[model samples]
Target: MKSLNHRTKVVILTAVMFVLLVAVYACGILISEEAVTGSFLNAKRPPCLEHPFGTDALGRDLFLRTLKGLSVSITVGLVASLISAVIAVLVGIAAANGSKWVDALINWIIDLVMSVPHTILIILISFALGRGLKGLLMGIAATHWCSLARLIRGEVLQLRSQQYVAVSRKLGKSSGWILTNHLLPHLVPQFFVGLILMFPHAILHEASISFLGFGLPPEQPAIGIILSESMRYLSTGMWWIAVLPGLTLVLIVLLIDKFGDHLRMILDPYSAQE
Candidate 1:
């Protein structure tokens, strides 16, 4: 009967997304290809009860492929976001609390990294690192840390100026302790927001790179791979394969983004409580 707070709303929405994702994945895994009602005689079919997303050019179940794609996308988002946030925190502390020269140097590097065209940079880096998930992950990680670093740096800077940090300095608390205990806690809200925001970017980049035939392998079931495969069938009237999968990818990213925005609002008590 109680009205939902922003946190409650975000939590509920996120849980629903997760459940849908799990259902799609579990069904894809448990339901064998033969058990799927998509008929070989009707390959590349449009949306129907037997095949909600229809079939691909080869008569493979597009719906099932979509579930596998979603799982792969989630893998990219989770790993890249975790790596980005951790690096952001560590580098941010060094930039904030280290010598002035160190701060200047690291800040310059962050700016430089962000100034490049992001997608192109990712592709170049991925290609340079060689192919597959290793390259894709490295490419994503290479570019994703700057915003989080800036956020954590700002929090560290603010915390560094507070009276408690000043007192800690006078008390001879090690720089490590001040950063780990005092500054890091101050970064919690920013860190969480940065993390949630990072999810969509990472997923999109992964999908984009894969779609371009640069990230995940062709045989691997991923949203990008589905879309890429669909391209060849587009002129042949198998639009649903690409279209439906693309829509699913967009929907997932958009829902995650909306939830991230809600989380940012909720976690920043200043904004909600204001």
Candidate 2:
């Protein structure tokens, strides 16, 4: 009965996660038409039945704009996290299987990258790349891989010492063959968890950079941009302008992070057994 309960819980969590992901991805499509058009006459309206999340200074529907921004953020997070995950997997494999000198060099690189503050490094990278969507994506993809790489490297190193792996080495299998056939399969769980874990970080960083005016342009209705724009109206009692969007962003990030945790729990053999 306990086992059945566990399975049911896992299934429910999986369904919830799937629905959340689909909703996030489809937010742009669902809200794009309304978000693109605004009316000055309806401007600065408070949250009500007609404008559930209120209207911006330009009379744009805050709810639609928020949804659109979240959709963009989710897209950026998905792409950046996938890129970071791939880079981590490749670097991790190289670090684990390469010569001692190569391993040392990769380890040093990882340490150097991780030693710096992520926000500072990301800002510098984004600035250097000219501060737009491209720069933001690059900054996020480049900075978020070190921890995942280290995790993968450690996992691969441990897998390499296993009896089955040793037997494969003795069977005249090439290094590439052993990696593809043995190491890669074993690293799937770590890779997936790491990838999902990176998503919230990517989204938050993207919003931060945009808020600081170093990410997506002002024309883009990103959460950061929304919050930044809302600053001018705060003294006039337009609190919902900032509060609603900011809370929504936080809620999305929390959901993604929780999803990652749940996924990790479901995928971990020990956790499943427990």
Candidate topping lDDT = 2
Evaluate candidate 2 by giving its C-alpha RMSD to the native, one decimal: 1.6
lDDT of 2 at 54: 97
lDDT of 1 at 103: 95
- Give one digit per residue, the lDDT tens place, for model 1 in 106-213: 999999999997789889988998879988998888889998898788878888889999999999999888877887677877878888889889999999999999
| TM-score of each candidate structure, all chains considered together | 0.89, 0.96
CA lDDT scores, all candidates in order: 0.82, 0.90
> Which portions of model 1 show Cα errors greater than 4 Å?
1-42, 271-274
Model 2, 1-274: lDDT tens digits are 3556775687687778879878776876577565557899999999999988899899999988888899889988899999999999999999988999999999999999999998889899999999999999999999999999999999999999899989988989998998889999989999999999999999999999999899999988788899999999999999999999999999989988988888888888887655
Could you tell me the C-alpha RMSD of candidate 1 in Å? 2.6
